[model samples]
Target: MQSRRKLRFRLIVSFALFGFGLSALFAFAALNIRTRVEDQLVNASLMDDAKWANQQAREHPGAPSGSRLLTGTVLSDRTLYKAPLTWQSLENGVHDIFEPGPDGEEHHYKLAVYREGGIISFLQYDVSREELGKQQLLFSVIGAVFLFGLLSLAIGLWLSRKVLKPVSELANRLRDFRKAGKAEPLAPHFADDEVGELAHALDEYSARLTAMVERDREFNSDVSHELRTPLAVIASTTELLQGSPDLTEKLSERLKRIERASRQATELIEALLLLSRAERRGPTRGETTEVGKVAADVIESQRPQMRGKPLSIELAVNAPVSVNAPASVLSVALTNLIGNAIKYTLEGSVRVEVGDGRIEVIDTGPGIKPEDAERLFQRGVRGEGAGGSGAGLGLAIVRRLCELYGWDVSMRPRTDANGAIASIRFS
Candidate 1:
């Protein structure tokens, strides 16, 4: 998975790492170069001292060792055999030697050997002081690396705060906009920079979004107002026709269906308008809807969907429940659940249960696939066995309505039969 840490955190980390790495590389290079130069100079000096000591021994036959030499006298056949075994094989060049001292600590030194015929000269120079100096330099370099890293971290903190200020201000303003339910231009509060450009873009997008929303609300209001007129006329006409003096029984039944459909359409329009406006169907104005009644009405309205499929519709009210919502909202939400249950079931039964602070529609039909259970509630998504000219928006509208009213809706496959159960839990 990718990291979700803020950009400022990443920037700070990058700065710290860069500073640490550069400082460490420079310190390492400096230490290496210094060690190489010091080693070269020490080796050359030791070699020159040895050669001069050899010349002096041959000229004066005996001479105190040069100041750089560890041995004052050159060993001959008698004394050479008694010298340290490591010094016996003398070559005409410089060499480095290491051996354990009497204290079990290793000794470090440079060896310069001069050999001529039966005479051999040995010169040694201890490098313990140089080793001590290199150790001190190593410690200093390590300290400097750490010091630079800390400085980088401090600088990162300050720079991140300064750099992210505009972005942070933008976020704050956006948050305030949400709380106030309004959008204001952010570019005015910022300087001409990348953040300012982002603010300008956001402003343009918000304006477009606000205009689109306004257009939608106006269109929905206009459509709903226009449609209410026809639905009223149909309802009044159906009532008048039902009172006809010679109305036949079959004709009367058909008229009653027409009346029910008109009423349903009117209620659905009110509910959908509330959804489009994103207005809560609150009970502030004496509106408390009974769950069982809405479920029954929705079931009756959806019966024509059966199409002589021999399907049974059932309503079970195990408990009395009421909600602080408009009856039309409940009607629309229940209509979707009950309608879906009826649509998918060719035969068998669709049962609606309203109680326990919620409602559920259980249907005996081709059960939903486990994977498609959640997707079924999404817009433009339908079950595999869906058979209709539906655009697959019923469940999506239902879900949006439920969210507006602080309710939850879900569907699950039934374990006992080839069916699905849809639920709405009111909160």
Candidate 2:
């Protein structure tokens, strides 16, 4: 497609070429008219001189007649009659007999003679009206071209803008429709040409995409619902086995590990379901939830999991902070960050800091490498030196929930002598 600048340039060039051709034609006609006028002037002058000379010679026989004397004197001037008369000269003069005579190309003359007591004289002069007419014609053509070109250009630009306005509006509407996860309908302007046809096709495509997304969402929801009952039964049976007294130490340890793994799988499945919900719609409707309270609750719930670890957990919540967000989503995200911090730091401490609309989880574990930091929150991607047996969905879930709630998440090396810090900023 041609850009606006290129289209304007093409139109200007076309108009200029057309104007130049017209100007050239006018100039040619003007030159032809001038040539014809010069020839007629020359012929008439010669005829008048001949008649005057003959009348003078018939009236006066001895002394030279006034007309004869005048003609002879004029022709004798070498500067005035530069070229001698020849066949070539006569033919050239006759061709333009109705056109402006040439000045430098050929010299014109007046001649007089007496024959049978009759004085005959011939006179010639060049006409220059053709050159003046050419000038006038050129000026008129130029003025007309400028006036018409400007008017046409103005009208063309106006029409182009009017015609393209509908397309521009439709583009903006389609962008909004996509962002809202809705189907875009054909724009009203799509009632005519190829652009209109394209708009209709886009509307059809968007409808299909919306339907496919809806189906995928329903499928994810159904699967999540079906798995909940089985997972709940398994969790309950594992708890029962752990409480029994007949188990040997080795068997008990193995069963405990299985129970932990099963619990982790259940948590991961729940996170996946939440993510699917967030993707299909958006963040859950927000309520005024106390951030500090949520943080304290998550810490208390996960305390048992850190019992034998050679690490300390610290909570440094300053002022009471509140935010409008889903309480469960925020709690889940904070729990994952704190868990990772505890799992990674072997012999140091993990700190959870809560402030105005913000939470930071810092751990004294081996700090993340620069390359690893970039992909830390990506699903199924574990950083080097991360704890073994981690599902790697913790940070991924945190990142997705933050997006759904319009929060910001960032990670950096902690300044305090040990690990990495993950920060979440709520808007």
Candidate 3:
């Protein structure tokens, strides 16, 4: 079977991903806005510095030392003022560039250039401190993004658990209901939401299922009770008819068959009733019966069926075996085992072995199919090679009876003999 991912894990991952995406989007927006605002502020500061320098240079044209300006005559091809290597690249406008300061520290500068009377003037404004502040703003935004992402992840986890707690509790309650055969009210503790609706639905389903189970048990009990009355009457009437002595041989045989059939029917009814009772109230204690005697009686009762075929049924007792179970249950289970043996075997004998707390029926019939062994005792299931006129309920009934009395039953193909062995071990 393919494994499934848990709902809680999916919920957590989905919420976490949503949080991460939202955090990344906000961080990107913040970084873009901070970059734009810092650029505008730097441009304004550089323009103000350029205007101030121009005013100073105009006021004191000859003494240019008071103002931070480099004035040079570009009419001749010679250097006239202190300039960097790339100073020629400056145009007649403000430009931001990087240059080395006196201490060799990297500095950001705004270079403003103007030309008049064959002379070129350049104004340089140091903006490295403002650049450092911009860098700090970038770092702070990055740090905020990281922190917010973590916070979002934490919040997602918390919310996911809060949302999935009711689901987990419902699962646990359902498990408890299965074990104890009862369901507790779930909507009382949860809020009025989707989870609460689900719990309420489950409560309704549980009620319906419990009612169906109760009705089924009652139906089976009532049917079994109704069946016993007629079966008892038939058994008593058959006994009375069998006691009559003025009958012919043919009539006597027919009556004997009727008596056997009636007794078998009555025993089946009793077994069914016992099985039904066991279902409702569990296994009940009964008389301790000798396993050997039970096996002998089963064989004797099956003798009539074996007469037509070349089959012999024998019972052997290794030790005085006994079990605490109803006599009818033991009889029905053994009868079904021996009957199957007799019905399937064409020419070989069927042996019944009784030991302490154990009974085994070894039949010289066609060995059971390996595939059928797994569900051999399931109701209405017949093996592929089972050549019989049965509805396949005998072994099922035997299984139910064994379960009722705390007995273990198993069936397997015999290795030494071309047949099968069915065993019941009592505890």
Compare the candidates by TM-score and give the number of the best one.
Answer: 1
User: Which candidate would rank higher by lDDT, 1 or 3?
Assistant: 1
Estimate, for each residue in 1-427, the C-alpha lDDT of model 2 and write its tens digit: 9556754456556555565566566666766776678657655555555566556555654545344323331122223244344311242112223322344454334332222231223333333444556577667766766666666566566665676667676778778876986654774556677778888888788778778978989998788778877877877887898889897888777766666556555655665776876642333464477878878777766666677878788888877677766566677788788877777777778888888768889888988876677599999987666457777777888899888778898788867576999899988
Worst 10 residues of 1 by lDDT: 64-73
Q: What ranking emerges by lDDT with the best candidate at the front?
A: 1, 3, 2
Off by over 4 Å in 1: 1-3, 59-73, 76-79, 99-106
lDDT of each: 0.86, 0.66, 0.75
**Number of the top-ranking candidate, with lDDT as the measure:** 1
For model 3, residues 1-427, the per-residue Cα lDDT tens digits are 9889888777777777776778778877887887788778756655554555555555566654323343222211244345565776566666877878878988877766654443455566777876687788778877877787777778778987898888888788779877986678877878899999998997898789778978978987788778878877877887787788887788878777777777777778778877765742322565477778877877777888877788888788988987766566788899998888888888888999888778899988897976677597998887544465778899999998888778899899998978989999988
Clashing residue pairs in candidate 3 (N, C-alpha, C atoms within 3 angstroms)? none
Worst 10 residues of 2 by lDDT: 87-96
Per-candidate RMSD, Å: 2.6, 9.5, 6.1
| Deviation (Å) of 247 in candidate 2 | 11
Q: Which stretches of candidate 2 lie over 4 Å from their true place?
A: 1-142, 161-193, 235-271, 279-309, 369-375, 378-381, 387-393
